[model samples]
Target: MSDKSAALFALTNSLQPVKRVWRQAATQIFANSGISMSLANLVVIVNRNAQGINQRDLAEEIGMNPGAMVRILDQGTEAEYLERRELSRDRRFKTICILPAGKKLADEIESSANKLRVQLMEDVSVEDIENATRVLRLLEARASNFLQEHIHEKK
Candidate 1:
């Protein structure tokens, strides 16, 4: 195989083991939470905002369909984790904000995630982590460009 293909093969092989390890740890940590992993992620997103954010903006940020966003919002509302308030300027736009309970849940989730990170990087040096983070950011930029180039725009 060419050098480029060989490098890609090695990189891909390395990712499989790392992915399995991290995902297994995450599954174990979240298994007893009574909430799906996806919902946990949504809770984090909702809690990231200071003044809350409009549902459409949230949907665009996550690339989710409007219907899917609405369903998640409804679920969050029913769970008393989020409150939707109408914007005064545009009453049609509803902003979703995390409740105090949701904020508390987010803190717990963050702690869990931090613990997992520490456990995963137990043997890795701090310098190595910094370097890896830089590389990951670069990879993210390249991947975004690649996807944009290959995927056709919606009409």
Candidate 2:
């Protein structure tokens, strides 16, 4: 690999183990709550949307398949954390609404995530973190554009 490619590979490769570790930590954090990371993420998104979000948008936002989104909705609905209601203007679409319980759980999830992030970021300077975030964002945009040119919007 070229030096730039090697460096990018190192950066991306290092993240996988950290991600695995965080998943394990998150599992433990949510052990008794019966909520996985994806479930918690769904609740957080629902809580953020003031008008509620439809199933398709929810699936896209969560980067999950529509069927998996429905399954997650089913789990949340059964747990009484959220509900899906048919939109008034669009009868065919159902918007996901976060119940009071879901709102509370979302808050807890945010708190736990913040705590974990703080722990994980220990000894890392704020400036360095910001720089890394900026670089990552730039790379993400570049990657998206590359895909659009080569794969998505193919000529």
Candidate 3:
């Protein structure tokens, strides 16, 4: 393989362990905090869109199926964490609103996540993190643009 190909291969191989460790740590933290990763994510998203977010939009944003989103929302509602309200003008559409309980849970989850993040990054230098974040953001943007262009070309 060429030097570029070899380097890329090594980078790709290295990413798996990093991703696995990060995910495992996050999962453990969430479990200990009495919430699943998906639920934590839902709480955070709902809390961020404080006014009210459409059910469909929320599902799409989280890359969840509409049915699954409904089930999750149902669970949250039952837990008194969220409320599904039908729009006054359009009964067909429902909005998901985070209740006070949900907000509190989201804050707790955020705090736990932040603590875990700090612990995980204890050995990493701030400069190294900044550079890595910059490179990752650039790669993400380029990859997104490439995908968009490719999709348009297919049309």
Candidates' RMSD to native: 3.0, 1.9, 2.5
Report the backbone clash tally of model 2: 0
Pairwise lDDT winner, candidates 1 and 2:
2
TM-score of each: 0.78, 0.87, 0.80
Model 2 bad stretches (over 4 Å): 152-155
Clashing pairs for model 1 are: none
Best by lDDT: 2
Ranking by TM-score: 2, 3, 1
- Candidate 3, residues 1-155: lDDT per residue as tens digits? 99999986886677779877876777776686666677777888999898989999999888899898777887789888889999999999999999999999888877887899898789999999999888777877988899999999999
Stretches off by above 4 angstroms in model 1 are: 12-21, 60-63, 149-155
**Could you tell me the lDDT of residue 95 within candidate 3?**
92
lDDT of 1 by residue, 24-95 (tens): 777667789787665666677789997998888888776688777787778778888888999999998899
Candidate 2 lDDT by residue in tens digits, 46-110: 99996789989999988899987788789899988899999889899999999999999988987
At residue 31, candidate 2 shows an lDDT of: 83
- Sorting all predicted structures by lDDT, with the top scorer first, yields 2, 3, 1
- Which candidate number would show the highest TM-score if scored against the true structure? 2
